[model samples]
Target: MRLNFSIKTKIILMNMGILIPIIIFIYVTITNNLYSNVIKSNIDLLTKESYNTQVYISNYIEKDKGVDIETNFVHKAPLINTYLSKKLNYRIQIYDKNGDIMTDSVANRVTLFDKDITNAIKGNKAYVVKKIDGNIYILFSSPIYLKDATLGCVRYIYTLDIEEKFINNMFIIMGILAFMSILISWLLSKLLSEKIVGPIKKLKTVSQKVTKGEYDNRIKIRSGDEIEDLAETFNVMSESIKDYVESLKEERQKQKKFLDNVTHEFKTPLTAIIGYSEIIPKLKKQSDIDESLVFVKEEGIRLLKLVEELLDLSKLGKSEFKIDRKKNNLKEIIEEVLIIINPRLKKYEIEIIKDLCDIEVLIDKDKIKQVILNVLDNAIKYSECTNINIKLQIENEKVILNIIDDGIGIAKENISRLFEPTYRVNNLNSINNNGNGLGLCICKEIMKKQNGDIKIKSNLQEGTSIEIIFEGN
Candidate 1:
């Protein structure tokens, strides 16, 4: 298992990890330095006292005019030790040339034979600081010289009771202050952690709600930082998901309606074919049989046409259904569409007016031809107009092809649904019309796959204008 810590706890731990060691190191260093300075000050004082006492005893022996200076100093050792110890307010000791203690100011006390005393007897001055019976003191020793002759040594033992007490009090005070500083830092860390983690907690809660399909809920962080930017991004993602789901639902409904319309369209022609076949066998007259047979053939053709258009509509926009877009003369393609649709135009007694422009564009040649044919067919069958105009031109760096009719135009409401599958204006269902309502739908899909678009504009009884736009090469 892994351990998980909250932001607040981590922040507190991090502060402690940084602060505790520093506090300890500073405290130890300060305490050691204080002790060293105090010890050094006492050593200096005791050394000075030892030097002065050595000079006083040396002068006193010199004035005695005795050839045995060692004997004279030994006899005067008690007096010198007493006088100097009283003047300096420190304990003192006198040693002979043999490193033996001759006299001490502290009477009947145990003689301390230490390294400092031995160094003084060897004609060198030295001092040492040590603890004895829980009391700290500095022992300083100096060699006493008389006219370059070896005499003896004087030693001083200075107590550091006051300095030790002061150091101890300072250590205690610093420790308490350190504890207080740590406490303050911990509290501040808690507050700071809360300030940082508060918004994050809100973000987590809102995210959980979004996971449960609550797309309307949004974060409201105003920190003016990256966290706020993240909240904005999260809101955008939620909105996108909501929109995608709604589009899917709408698409599913459209699919259901498309299926129902396909079934109805197929059933109508099939029902007519079946009915005409049943009547043909019962009819006795030769004309009647031929007429019935003709009806069957017509319905069969209509049904076949519907199936082919449905197949074309289904393949558009699918990955496997590729559109081979290449540079082609759009004006020539429009002429080809007019030629193919010429027979139907003449049968309807409709006149064609052309305003063609020479321009090349990137598009699938056959698909553009089909889209053009489908639009012209719709115009011939439903527009009820005398003349259909075909125009191609380059406008604003785009190749635009327009097939407009001055006929009984569609309503504004119906124009919007013109590209929808099986959507008809005024429900124009008849044999001559022969529309399964997939022509415009197929045209729209083809234009989209070709990286172009088709749009329609119409007003009831006025006219219909169909615009096809493609990027010019």
Candidate 2:
């Protein structure tokens, strides 16, 4: 099984992992040093007192000439030790060369010589710690030398009550301090973890919301760090996904409508052709039969044209439909399109106005020409205008071609869907145009492939304007 831990918990654990050992080590080190110093201080005091006693004895022997150390020292030992013990606040003992206790300040008859006494009698100083009656004590021993003669040893037995209490109190304080440090570390780690993980939690929440199709949710963080950058990027991703989903939904609606329109367009022509063919055989008059044949032929032609336009639209929508782009004079291409569309213009009694600019650009000549032709044809067929204006110019480092008509124009609401496949504005001019709605759609796809775009502006009964933009030279 996996162990699950929040960032906050991990941070606290890591801090404890580092601090606990250090606190323990510091406590141990400090207490150990303090105890050692206390013991050394007591040993040094005893050595100084032992030296003073040795000097006092040597002076007394010199003052009382002809007096031996054993007789004189033994005679003054009790009084001297009593005074030394009263001054030093320690239990004092004097031992002979044989390690026999000669005198005791505490008046107890103790005969056995311990390690400290034995070492002192060997003409060396020594100290040892011992537990007496559950109380700690330091036994310090020093040798007394009288004019290069080893006279005896003086031992000081000092109670370590004060030092032991001080050490114990220090340990308690350190323990409390360690606890406080741990507490502080936990608090700091918790705060720091919250600072880091707070934004991440918001991101996770927003992500969950986005998964449920709530794309408007966003993270608001301003830590001035990578987390802030991540939040910003996450918000952008949410917006993009929202836009893409909406576009997909819109495209799906358009597809459904396109299918409906295609079915209706096909059905109308097929119904007319089928009705005319069936009725022609039953007609009695030759003139009626001829008219019926004409209707069938016309419907057949319209059906064939619709099929061809649908095929063109399909090809344009595919990835394999590549355009051959080359440098060409845009003015010449526009004039060529006008030449092709002139017959229809004459048929409709429509006058054309041209204001062309000689601009060179990289484009697929055939595709660009076809786009111009489609727009002009739509204006001529649907706009019902007498004058169609064609203009080419450069704007903002881009070549722009505009075709405007002074005829009954499209409604504002219908302009947005003009490039969608098989979308037709339900107006009188649009109904009577008899042009497949895929023309403009194909024009749009071609422009897109050419790294250009098409835009339209229209007002009811005023006119329509088509703007085609291409990358400039």
- Model 1 agreement with the true structure over 108-202: per-residue lDDT tens digits: 88877899888888899898877999998788889987878667788888888999899999989988998998999999999888777977788
The candidate that achieves the highest TM-score relative to the unseen native structure:
1
Q: Which stretches of candidate 2 lie over 4 Å from their true place?
A: 1-7, 109-112, 195-473
Off by over 4 Å in 1: 1-5, 198-473
Return the TM-score for candidate 1, rounded to 2 decimals: 0.41
lDDT (Cα) of model 2: 0.79
Q: Write model 2 residue lDDT over 3-68, tens digit each, in one string.
A: 998767876898999999999899889988998899888778777877887777677656766788
Give the lowest summed-lDDT range of ten residues in model 2.
263-272
Give TM-scores for every candidate, taking all chains together and pairing residue i with residue i.
0.41, 0.39
Residue 142 Cα positional deviation in candidate 2, in Å, after optimal superposition: 1.4
